[model samples]
Each structure stands twice: as C-alpha cells, then as structure tokens.
Target: MTGTLKLPHEGTPGSSAEGLDARLVVERGAFRLDVTLTAAPGDVVALLGPNGAGKTTALRALAGLVPLTGGHLRLDGAELDRMSPESRPVGVVFQDYLLFPHLSALDNVAFGPRCHGVPKSQARAQAAVWLDRMGLTEHSSAKPRRLSGGQAQRVALARALATRPRLLLLDEPLAALDARTRLDVRAQLRHHLADFEAVALLVTHDPLDAMVLADHLVVVEDGRVVQEGTPSDIARHPRTDYIAHLVGLNLYRGEAEGHSVRLDAGPGITTTEDLTGPVFVAFPPGAVTLHRDRPTGSSARNVWRCEVAGLETHGDQIRADLAGELPLAADLTTVAAAELDLRPGAPVWATVKAAQTHAYPA
Candidate 1:
C-alpha cells in the first residue's frame, strides 16, 4: 500500500475539535431504543450486543437512514439531526460491502465522489489513489463478484474514506469472511482504524473483535446501554451476565459477609475477597473441578452436588454444563472427562478453591 496517498478532508478547519457526541433515541412499532454515545477524534468504539438489541438500528440512526424520535446528534459542533443520509458528513462500511455488481472496483470507489459533483476524471483519479493505498490497484478493473471477500471489504472502506467523512461507521465489517480470512482482515482493519483521525464506531457481536479493534466498548441490551468501558475493564469486571458469558466467566450475584457469599441463586461459595454487602462472584470454567464421588478432606472451600446438564467440545477441552446446588460450567481435559464417565444426567461433585474465585461489589 502506498504511504503517500492522502484522503480528502485530512486537514479541514475546526477538525481538531471534530468528534461525535450524541444521544440517539428511535421509536419503531413496539420497540424503543435509547442510547448515549460520545467519542473524541481518533477514538474507535465498538457497539456489541445480541441480535435484536438495536445495534443496527443505532448505526442507521447515525447515518440518517433512520429518523430519531428524540435526542440530538452533533459532530464538530454541527447538528445533524435533520440531515439527509446523502448530505451528512458520515461514511459507512456496510456488512455486505454493498458494492454495485455492475461497477468495477475503481468505479465503485469513485461513485461517492462522482455523486458529490466532482468531475468524472478527477473522481476516478482519487479512486486510483485510494486503491493504491489499499494495495488493490491491480484489481481495480475487477467487478465485485470477481473480488474476494477481503478485497471487497477493503474496496468498500476505500470508497467510504474517499468521501472524507468526519465519522466512520462499520457494521459487522468482518462478519462475512471465513475463519482464516477474518483473522487476517481483522488485523488489517485494526491498522487502518489506527490511522483514521476521525471518530469511528464499529458494530460487532464478536468479543475478540471489540477487544482488538476498539479503544472502548458499549454493550447494548434490550435497546439500552447496559455497560460501557475499556475492553480490559469490561472483561475483568463484567456488570451483566451477558458480558460475563461473552468474556468466558461463570458469574453469580450474592450477599457477601467476610469471605463467604451466599448466592441469590440458592447456593453459597467461599471467595478470597474480604468484604460485605451485595457482591458478584466469578471464576473461569477451568477453575472448577468435577469428580464422580465427593473427595475426602479436599483443600477446596467450595463444593456442590451437581448433575451434568450437557457437555460440548470446547477447543481441546470438554466444557460440561452442570446444574444443581451451584449451577455453572466446567472445563476439563478429554481424558479427565472420560475417566469420570461424564454424560448428561450423570451425578457428580464440583469443587472450586477460594483463591480461584473473584468477588466484587454488585
């Protein structure tokens, strides 16, 4: 990729203070979405949630494709609440790339500039520069169907950047690629985002994508903002069960006294933290050990009688879902699982050491 290719609006006036500040609210049928977002220039924020959580709706509202019923949107001190999608200083890389089937890669990149009234020759010239930066100059003549998934993604991104947007929005940018291609494209996208000087918002369901590409995370649930923090902070201190599951931790809430926490779910567990009041206790699945029979005089402080609800292969480990006194998941080696003769409906004892658990304020 060429290092000298310059995007339009690189040094626009007042761009130093160009950032995103908005409270987005949209009402449709029986659903209402209310979310607040703020980001400084050069910040990449990821919006993550389960399906039907309004992630796509939020993106559409920002792009002016959906009208907001309440709240406001401001970018660089300009109100965009009434702006049309084509009039807003925003660029979006859609999930499917959405490249025109009949247009060549270069023509697709030039389309936005052409629509904005730039001369056809000048627009194509700018498109060539962008393709050069993306290291796709050789494929500029290929149609979208002829381009690979990764190549189509970059072309879409180049098209967005050519329009010189102050805010870039990506909707599931890597969701279309295969596993191996997703890995390579994710890294490439991260590098490109680092070079973007404007505020960027990314929507994705993958926790790893949010952690690797974004400086901050906003987790939406049921059309509302449930949590927002740095990826590390959110992963370490999940405030919701959905987040805990996303981060691969078995989480529970309970009333704490000293080092013991009596869970709201009916069981009690011992932790290493010394505190009182309501709290959350969590541990990794790998921290739990299962046995066919209760061990005698074990060092573990927490033990419960559980029955196997189900089992699944998780990478090289067996992830057993247990239901009983303290419902949770446990990861063990295949050999260990086989030795215990594990299966659905099988009775077993689960144990976790106090030091393996983490407790914090609820």
Candidate 2:
C-alpha cells in the first residue's frame, strides 16, 4: 500500500509537474460542448456556471466517466483520453458522498487500495492512516449509515486521497451539508485540498464556494468557456451579465470619450479613467446613493432620476430596485432606507461619483 504507483507519462522537462492539459469536446442529442482547459500543479480551478452549462459534463470527461466525442485529455502529461476510468490516475468525490452503506468507514477507505491489489491488512493499515489524518480514527468502525453528513464527506475525501491521484475532481463538495455544517466542512476541505499537490477541479454554481475555495475560476456558459481568471480579477471586472450577477455588480457596456462613457441604454457615466472607444462601466450597488430628490450643490457627475420599483433586505443592507430613465440597483443601510421613507413607486434621484465608477475596455 505504501509503494509508489507508476507515474503518468511526463510531456517535457519544462512542463508543470501535477497539472491537467485537456481539450474536451462532448456532444449529446441537442447540446454541444467545446472547452480547452489547463491547470497548474496545486491549483484549485473551479468550473463555475448555472445549470445546463456543461460544468458537470466537463468534470466527468476529465474523470474518464464520460467519453469524449473528440479532443485530448492529458493528466500529469500522460494521455488519458484512451484510458478507462479505473486505469486513469484520477480521484472523484461526488456530491452525494457515494459511500457503501454496508461498509464501515475504515473499509470504505480501504476499498481503493484493495482494488489496486494490496492485501486486506495492508489496505486497512493504509486506510487507517488516512482516516487518522482526516480525524476520523474514532469512527473507523462506524458504518456509513451511522455517520453524520460531514463525517461521511470526510470519509469520502479520505478514500479518494488514499489513492494518491494525480488529478482530483470534486462536484459540489459542500452542497449536501446543512448551513451550519457547510461552514465547518468548507474550512476543513480547503485545508486538505491545499495540501494536495495534484491538480484539483471543482464544479459548483455557488459563488461563495467558488470564491472561498478555489484560487482560479473558469466560467462556462452555453457549453463554452466564456471567461477564466483569478477570483479577484473576475470579481473586479466581470465581462458577462452572468458573471456580473455572480460577483454582485451592475455592469453596462458603452462607448467612452475622455472621462465619460455613454451607455447603450441612453445614459452617460463619468469615470476617473481617461480612455476612448468601447468600454464597460461597472459599479457595485453599494457605490450608488439614493435620494428623495436631486440634491443641489452635489459635485457628483453622474445622477439619474429613477423610481423605486421594489425594495428588499439583503443581509444588513437594503437593495433598492429602481426603474425610470435608466434601470439600476442601489444598496443602502436599512436605517437609511427607513429614514428616506423609501418605498415602491417612490421618486428618487441616484448619484454616483466619477471616481467610484470603473470603466474598462469592452
């Protein structure tokens, strides 16, 4: 059980040690997918998208569970497109934590080693080591049915890691947990995943999970990769409406002249940047200030007259959905909203300073 498994074929001396290089294409009845992806060793790349965006399909292709209609898959420089799921040096933890109900936690983790030809005793020994690492030694004899959701998840993780895979695929690792358990499990998962030297790919629609757990993000839409960058980069300047909504920002595409940008929706916004040509204007809801009426002596360059279409509490703040000359979203304190007597159909003026508005080339 402690012996080294055969390493996957290395491409070149300069290539990354434990990453994935793949150009995956899968076609079903009416849907088509084409995505080229790469991840560096120890990089946690999250495939983020809404349902039917092909995130799961891509991950399955990487795991060799789904056959590729075309394109290549290489893990740690070894060709995997032709390998069977069992032959590939990959590990996967499904969302449901598919542990055998009849098996003890110790036996569950030992299954992989036993399948790989190790003796039962040796396999259990290795499994015990992994369980210990996961802080599950005391529960080694517990059956899967008797384990808590988080405990079962850890057992699943330990089972996968015990195999020492070159690539790890996780599908919604924290989705099955309750709100209270999610917070604890999320932190533990982060620590374990960080220690993994192999490439890890996670598929999740939850932005909080993606932002908190992954170092980089790959955003897919309509079966195509629309964007890929670090979490902070995507958060700072989102190019798509889906991404904007994911990162909680209001985005507008427009043409820029000097320090001002003219939106296609018939409004011009001033910005600190002095750029010309096609641009994107983005501002968080918190940057917007709502007023009952246009305030005099206001130096703010960008002001719009709008009517409150709706209001809702978002955490400690109030989100005002407005409709009028230009539809926009603004966030204010609940106290402020109450003081302003903000309500549906209330006339209001929204103001945003040029410095607070960010403009980037579209």
Candidate 3:
C-alpha cells in the first residue's frame, strides 16, 4: 500500500452491532475471506473497499447466498450459520436488480410474499402498497425490461422490503444508474432506509454513497477489515493510505514525541497534537501551501523540499501529486498552479502549519 499503512488487530468483533451479527469465513481454494460485521436494528452499515476486497462476498454471506466455511452467522441472537438461503430472514437487492424479465413490477415484488405462502390477492395487494410507497404505482404493470434503471432499482428495493426481512443486504444498489438518475434514486433510497426499522448492510466502493446511507463503515482490504468506525470518524482520521485517498487527505505514519513526528519516510514533521510513541499524522491536501522557494518567517514548522510529480484539475482546485523528501498530495488553486508554472518535475516546496496537522495514536 502506498498510503499510511496499519494492520487490523486480529480478533472477532465480539458483539454484533445490535440486530444482525456475523463473522464470515469463506475459503475458496487458496483465497480466504474473513470479516466480522454487525448492525443494530435501524442501523445502516456499509462495507466499503476496492474491487475484489470481499465487500460483495460479505453481503452474500449475510443473505445466505454464499455459505460460510467457518465462523458464526447470527441474526437477533439466533444462530444462522447452517440455515439455508430460503429459510433465513434476509432480503437482497443485487447490483443488477435481478428482476424477472417476464414479471411485471407488481408481480416481481409480490413474488417474495407469495412464496412465503401469502394468498395471490393478498400478496399483490401488499405489492401495490409497496409500489405506491416507491412512487411506482403508475408503472406497476410494466415489465422489468420496460422500467428505467432507477425504476428497476426501486422495484428491487421494494421487493426486498416486501419480504419484511429482519436483515437487508444491498450490493451496489445504485451502481447501475446514470448520474442524473443516481441522484434522484439515492434520495429515495435514503428516504426508504430512514423508514426501515431492520438492519441494512450495503456494499459499495463509492465513498459518497457510504457516507450518505450508512451509519457506520467497515473498510475491507484483501479480505480483512482494516478499519471500522462511523463515517465522520473514518473520514477525519483515515488509518491507511487507501483510506486517506478515499477521504482526500495526506497521511503519514511516524513516531511521535510531543507535537513532533519523525516520519518513516526519513523526514521530521511538527504538529499541534501532544502525543508520544507510535502515531499517525494527517492533514488535508488543502492545508499544504506550495512555494517556489522555501518561505521565510513562517510559523509552519512542517516544511519539505519537493518536486511536482503530476498535476490535474480536481473540482475548482488543481491537485498536485508531489514526490520528494516527503511524499504527499497538495491542493492548489488554478491561479496558483499557473503562477508557479506547475508541471511535471517542477521544483517546489510544500509547507504546512503545525496547527493544521492532526496526530493520533496509531
């Protein structure tokens, strides 16, 4: 990992969050995925990580789609490790919506209830109510092929909820929608989730989606959970470089003494935090100031000699990926970038104030 690295302390999560509890271990050939996930009733937990990080696999495990090779699977204190997929109280919304091509929107949702022994009329009536709540009553008779991506996603969600499962698993629920449609569907999804009283677990690589829909976050990498915390906590103090990049911050691992840190990268940096022993130092890219020459008479003790490795526009700012005595990313305005004639291999210096840096025990 190119970012600040920290390994997860090995141990089970002990107690599940509240409503759903799971410690999943799936062994396929030489690869293994071990993850502990928990969510209280009414809580939304997100499994966020890079591709092939086992987020979807964890979701599948919860829904009983994938059998756990080892570890416990529980819902509301009931052991479900050996339960069959159909017998488990789980609802799933797949990334692709997985709707039946020939079934109408109403029938698609009614299918779950009907399979559970509900009368045909009663199931269809319940499906109608769910469709109304999803604002899809007008399209109830439309087949899956006739629905737009957003509509299809809502129908899938409605179907999942129609089962009234105690645990809901959504795999990249909004991944298939267009940008314009995603915004609208995301709002509706959030609204629906707010009303849902059951435990909900979603898998996604998009940080925005996780932050928006989830109450807690579990960052998985290489089949291991590296970090777990609230969205705000993870965003403010990312433990790994991958997480730092996800949250748009520059992070470093170092040994701390008071407010000073001796970075592992062979440079010393100062921060305002009072700490000691091993620690993590983090600062937003916006906190970095670029200078053609080291600035004179500044209170910012954290200064480094660097050269621009790359530059690109990010939103309203120009982000410069720097490599030098201290490796980090810097955010500069378009105006500042042009003034410095910032380009690849340009000699530059970066400075950050001690107060701007955050140091915490690793």
Candidate 4:
C-alpha cells in the first residue's frame, strides 16, 4: 500500500464526481474506439456488441490498463486518466477469475485490502464478511482449483468488493460459467449490483445479460456507439439494423412520405405512421405472412416474391430466412409450416399489412 492510495468517497451512498464521466478515444494498429458515457451513482451500464467491437478496450481504458489517444476518464469527480490501475478507486472482475492458484479463497479475497495497507487480521475479517455475503464462508479455505466455476466467480467478486471500489467494472464476468451456473450466478450478481451505490459497468455479448443486469445499454459496433438507452427502449425502438436484428425485428432504411416509405431497395412500403425525409421501417417476423401465389384485393400493401433461403425450428415456431426484393425473416407455427411445405429454395409470396409496419424518422 502507498500513502497516495485515496478513497473516492466516505461511504457508498455519495460518489466521487457524480458517478463516472468518460469520453475515450484509443487508436491502435488501424482500429479506433471512440465512446462517451456518463452514469450516476447506483447506475449499472452495459457495453454490448459482437466480437472485436472494442468493448474490452474501453473497459481497459477506464481501468488504466490501456492508454487513451484522446478524451478523459473521471470517476465520482476525481480524474483517473493519469492514474495507474491500482491507484484508482476502481475494482474489476475479469472474465477469468484470476485467483492465485496457491491461495485459498479467504486469502484471495483478503489480498486486495492487505495490499491497500489494511492490517492482515483486519483484512482477513473483512474478507470473511464478503465471502459470507457471497455464500462462500464454508469454502473459504478451498483453493481456486478446488472451487466450482460459480464459486470461483463469487470469490472474484467478493475480492473486488472487499477493496471498496467506487467504480466496479466487470468484463464478461459470467462467460466462464456453464448455462445452469450462469443463471444462478447472474441472479446473485444482480442482487449485489443493486446494493452497490457506486457506478458499475459490464461488457458482454449476451442480450439476456444486458437486459437483466444493466439499467442502460450502450450498443457498440465498428469502434463506435450505434445506440444507447434503457433496455426496454432499445428493444422497442432500435435505431440501427444491427440493433433491430439483435432485438429480432426486420428493419429497412427508406425515404418516408406520409404513410408510405420508399425503401432503399425493393418496393415502397405503406406504414401506420406519417413521417417525412429519411426514415426507418420495421416489423416483426411474426407479422409477415407467406403465400404460395400472389393474391389480390388484400389489405396488406407490402408484398414481395421471396425465395426461402433457409428454415430452422425456433421453439414452437419455425423461422424462415428469405431473400428477394426484400430480404427478411418470417416466423410460422409448425402446423402452418407443414401446411405450406416450406423448404429451402422454395418460391413464396410475402405480405405484411400497412398497419403492421412501424415507421420512424431516421
């Protein structure tokens, strides 16, 4: 422990600068990451995206493990950009629980506090409290290799919290656990995060994790934030095709005029909302209907000759991925699928009512 080790706050209730204020830009070997973010105390923000999207890079920048080419990082109100990882009032739970192989769970949890100058006896006592909170008191003497995946994750979390960080960053925290273990650990982690008054951020590609664990979602792609909002908001109104697909909606970019939109490709679509200029049109796969032949005198204004490119069973329904004038997806029940005799390379007519389509300004 150094004399310069500073506590960001007196207690968890009030935080350093408000919570966290970060605007980061890091350029590395032709890849660039730029993002701006802010969160109040008690807020849990998630950075979600596909592989190589720089979610880990942004997290590394906040932890001072990676240098920023531009922008700044502040937690509570103290500037952390110039500080080293250990000097900042931040704690991280990495994807892999990096507990020392030779150490017991109790010792692993005590190490952080001990390094920060807490007396050995005092740090061990505090470690016990955290282990108890994580339901690992009985396994405190077990080594990392002896613990289960879920147990190891709890110890890592306990160890991080033992240091009393005002900013908690978890990178793929549940990635190592199996499906059943992940569910249990995820539920436990949610409860702990709710009790934490400090700002928390996590990086993950799992939509369920982002939806259940975070209060806000920052969707990143190609080194930039494509969308950011509450989970419900992002689910209901996706701003980009990637997000739309992520939320399971078929999206299209178009120019809107009144109740109709001229799609960038294929035919124009009539929608429920009246909008002008560049716009986005979206609809659910379940809203689409497929017919063997083109029918007339139907209320549906959007119809296209589509060929089924593939079909797969999705729970109780079947998902058909189609390509044609409009590339889209359609969901149908097994009975309907059997009746239509749907298959790959099959010609089908797709129809969607104007009222089923949603249009929003781009």
Candidate 5:
C-alpha cells in the first residue's frame, strides 16, 4: 500500500460532535435498506438479524463501502455523508480481518497511522504499543499467515483502533475463530469494547455474541429496525415473532382480558398476567409437556390437541414443532420423545401451565 485507501465518498468532514447519529438508506435493484442508528461514547451496539435482513448493508453504509441512497451519518458531531472511506474518522474490523499478507503484525497495525501521513518510525512505535496492549508482543514480527485466528483478530482490532477513530464498526468479528478461540476472543473483545472511549457497532449472526458483546441490541428485518433494546428486555418481552424465535421462546399474539387471552389463531389460553386489550404471550419450549393422548384432570391452564410437524435435536434435548389449534414448539428429552414415539404428523397433546407463560402488552 503506497498511499491511503482511495475509496470514494466515505463521508463529508464537518464540525465535531459528541456521539454517533445516523439514518442509513441504500437501494440496490429491488432491495432498499432504511435504518436509523444512534449511540453515545463507549456504547457497543450489535446489529443482529437473519440473512438478507440488511445487517451487513447497514454496516457497509456506515463504513462508506456502500453508498447511501439517502439519510446521513455523523460521528461525534462531524458529518460523514460525503467523506471518502479513507477520510472518515471510522475504523472497521472485517470478518476475516483483511490483514496484509506481506506485512508483519506490527506493520499491519501501523498501516492506518502510516496512511494518515505519520512517519514510518512513529507509526511502528504506535503499532508496538497496540500489540503490547493486545498481548501480541511476541508475535509483532510474525506475518498474517503465521498468526492464529485469535491473534489475527486482535491485530485487526488494534489496527482499527490505532488511528483513534470516533466510531468503530466490526462485522462478525468472531465468526472466523473456532469454538474455543471464539470464547476467549469474545471475552477479550468485550473487555476492549468496555474500555473503548468511542462508539462501537458490530454485526453478528450469533445471538450469544450479540448478548455478550453488546450493551444494546438492534434487530433489523427487511432493511428496517424491528426492535432495539437492552438484551435482557428483548429476551424477556419479545414483541415480534422473529425476536421470540431468536430468543428460543414460543410466542403468540392475542387479545387479553384479565387472566385469559384469546389467541389470534382462535384458541384461548389462561395466563398469570392481569392485563387487558392486545397482548403477546411467550413461554420457553421447555415449559411445554407433551402427551400421546389428552390428559384428564390436568392442572395446566393451557392444553391443545396437536400433531408433530417436525422433530430435531437441539443440544441434548429434542425440539418438536407442533401444529394444532395453537402451533408452538416443545422441548423434551430423547427418552421422553422415544416414549411418546414422536414423529412428523404424530398426534399429541401439549400443555403449559399459566405460571410458565409470560404476558406483555402488545
């Protein structure tokens, strides 16, 4: 790299601001992404969603890799709408790290400051400090091919931070690491993010990653923000089916009056919540009990005649997708699944105690 990245139209330079405020809009053929994101210093927000949900598009738009069809981007207070990617005060850690194959770890981290006109010696000195902070001092002279996945990731992060960007964007930062490496890197990344003085945004497919590394979660669906909130709140009171499924809960929408809720699909279930009007009912799959035949004199408040639509192993338990008066998922042990002879199209009765269900206003 003789000169800095020559990317076109990253953003427009302007007066400084304190935090990030962005409304990103990008159109490609039939897909149009429109999302707004805002955050303060030291905030780590994770963009999470299914494939084709525009999470990556949002990140790219922020990085100036993808042009914004509309909307605006600001970091601290500086407008980033028309600045070139290299000119914007932003750092990006790609999924694969994208470290230079020909450069050593120290040189790779120094590359950013070097591009900004810093002398070679000064840049290398800064790179050394970053490598020390990342605990990669021994690997400073190692090439990218010789560095492990975790080490490469840390180097990429250090490179991004070396320039002291006001906004940091990370795309699937841990996806390349193995399970063991991911666990360790995730913890290290979390600590770094906690200490980061600037705003940080990351895109990840893994719910655990979003929950652990981000202080806030932004769930985008169909190029729009479906939900954004604290991880625990979204996990507890999911407002959409996508969110419910993401959190491993069976969710239903209904009209609630006192303790009873009339489901949209024409079934009524009793809940422990005292609410009125529209409400959403949610319960974990593990809370459901399945029986081959209808049970009599059961104390459970919710029971439905159902047929197994599918069965799959979920970790150590079997997850059964049931279709009936009220469609939902149930979790059972392999022994119980075998005892019930669970299979697609097999008739079964499912029950969930009201106490196990959570109800919230829609």
Candidate 6:
C-alpha cells in the first residue's frame, strides 16, 4: 500500500537555522514501517513504544544506517535520501554507549571531529568544551572501562554533540544508567538538548523520559504511529490500552448522547463534555472511590458494583484491579483502602463524579 504525508510547519533558530524532515518507508521480513516526522530547529521529539514497534528502525533510517524502501529524507532543505551515513549531517548516540575502549573520554569525543578532518588540537579543544559542559571535565582522562555507566552516557552524548550535526538521534539514552544517576543525567541531558540549535529525535519506552525531555511525542505500535501530540496531550487522551497504562489512566470508549454515555459493557456514565455520537470517556484510577456497601447521598453520578480480582501497590498508591459488569482499575490511598477494608474477592461499589469524567469524540 501507498501513503501520503503532509509535512508540518517548523520554526527556524537563527538566520541560518536548519531542521529535519523525513518521510520514511522501511520493510523487513513480514513487517513494514512508515513514518513521517518533522522537527523544527531545537525541537526535541520522542519516539515512544514497546519492543518491535519500529522506533529504532525509524531512527536508523533517518541516520542513513537503514535504507528506506521508499519516501524522502531531507535536512535543512538538502536531500539526504541518497547520502551515505558519513555524508549525512547527523549524529547518533547508540544505547550501548559505543565508546572506543582504547581512547580516553576526551579522545572518544574528539574522534568525531578528527574523522571530519579537524586538526588534533582543535578537535581536542572542542571535545574538552563539550565534556566540561556535561560536568565531566574531571573524567577527561578516564577511559570508558574506568567510567561509570552515567559517566559513559555523558561522554557519549558529548561526543554526539561535538560534531555539531544538523540532526541528532538517540536510542534508549538513559536505559543504561542506575536510578540515582538516571535522574541526574536526564536533567543534564535536557539542558544540553535545549542548548542545541537543531532537531533531535530520541527513541525510548520510558514514559517519564519522553514527557520530561521532549516537547512532542510520537507513539509507535506494531510498526506504525498510533498517536502524535504534545506530551500533556498524549498523557491526557491516550488512544490505546498500552498508552492508557503508560499514563496511569483508565480509558473507555462508548456512544454518547448529550451528557450521558453508555459503555459497551452495559453501564451509563455522566460526562462533562457536551459531545454526541461515539465518544471516549477517560479518568485517572485515583478518580474512583470504592466502598464496601452502596453509597448514600453521594454527589457522584456514576456508580457501579464491582468485584476486586487483584490488588497491587504502586509506589505510595494502591491499585486495585476489578472485574464485574465493567472491568476497571481503581487507585486509592492506603489509608482509604484500609478504612474501606478493601481486599481481593471483596464486592464493592465504585463511584466517579461527572465533573471528573472527561469525554471526547472517539
């Protein structure tokens, strides 16, 4: 099958600013991936998905590491579809932090400049500047073997940035770091990415990374883009179960008439949206209140009788998985749960206020 993609408007940085534009179609084995992406100068776009979602495949296509079976690739209005990897004005940071073990941190970063024909002195100077910006000046002489995971990641990012490419690509950037180091490095990475004056694309399965680091998000599933929007937009209105769980929201699709919506499972809910026809109703699990018995004088208009099938603790909140006429998930504080004596195999009434139920056209 063939498809057409309309390029989106992009902003320029300085008078000579450049951006990235790609419409790629790549096929391998039984799967074919197609994506059209455009990022303005200094825009950070995250490609989010689970395994086998083609996030990495799309990144590689843009970097010239994977040949596109069809479509076009352009950077700064220059055609790059036929260019080799070295000829493309792009930089990549792989997941493994592929630093040359024989070289020191400074030398590893300088390698890119050296390959581009810069003098050794100039390359090392530029490398030093990038390392210092990453707060790794003290580790300049340390080799990859001697550097910790976080240190190595910083060095990798510095190396990628040293080349001053018009487009940057990163794959699972923070996946290798420990929890403590991940937080620190993520913040530092965001700062440096912000300072960059070109387009940057990151591929990751981590929701927090995408939300915190990127201005826009593209969610890919099964080798296709399922959703694309701002981070807050995707979090607020997820289109699939995978994304609903990712953003910690309970989502339901139903037919709506005025303010009332009937679920496919045989229950009606009151919504605040003045929408009609098919619509989606969504609310966070925390919006649900569970009681052992039927509630009295409760202002909440939507209530359902549910049976607890499982329970689990998610950080400070308790997530109770319920199954009944309408299978749903609810989150509550440990204190509230204790007061309600909630447990597996217990029957309970679930209530949600109409104001809290968000409705949008499906």
Q: Name the best candidate (by lDDT).
A: 1
Q: Which digits, one per residue and each the tens of the lDDT, describe model 4 over residues 1-362?
A: 11221234543455345789999899999999999989998899999998999999999999999999999888867789988889998899999979999999999999999999999999999888888888888999999999999999989998988899988999999999999999998998898888787789999999889999999999999899999999998997888877887889999989998998999987899998989999988999999999988968677888899999999988689999999989999999999888888999999999999889888878
Give each model's clash number: 0, 0, 1, 4, 11, 0
Q: Give the residue spans of candidate 1 off by over 4 A.
A: 4-17
Question: Least lDDT summed over 10 consecutive residues: which range in candidate 4?
Answer: 1-10
What 10-residue stretch in candidate 5 is worst by lDDT?
1-10
Against the correct fold, how does model 6 do in TM-score?
A: 0.93
| Candidate with maximal TM-score | 1
The superposed Cα distance between candidate 3 and the true structure at residue 160, in angstroms, equals 0.5
lDDT of 6: 0.88
Worst 10 residues of 6 by lDDT: 1-10
**Which residues of candidate 6, in runs, are more than 4 Å off?**
1-17
lDDT of 3 by residue, 1-362 (tens): 01111112122334453477778999878778999987777788999999988888888888888888999998877787778899788899999989999999999999999989999999999899888888889999999989999999989998998888888889999999999999988987888887777788999999999999999999999899999999999998899988999999899999998878998886998988889999999999999999999889777888889999999889999999999999889998999999999999999999999989889889
**lDDT of predicted model 1:** 0.93
* Root-mean-square deviation of Cα positions for candidate 2 versus the true structure, in angstroms: 2.9
Candidate 2 lDDT tens digits, 199-312: 889999999999989999999998999999999999998999999999989899999999988898868999999999999899999999988879787889999999999999
Those runs of model 5 whose alpha carbons end farther than 4 Å from true positions after fitting are 1-16
- Cα TM-score per model: 0.96, 0.94, 0.93, 0.93, 0.94, 0.93
lDDT: the better of candidates 5 and 6: 5
Quantify all predictions' global Cα lDDT against the true fold: 0.93, 0.89, 0.88, 0.90, 0.91, 0.88
Q: How many Å off is the CA of 348 in candidate 1? A: 0.9
Q: What is the lDDT of residue 41 in candidate 3?
A: 76
- Residue 321 lDDT in candidate 3: 94
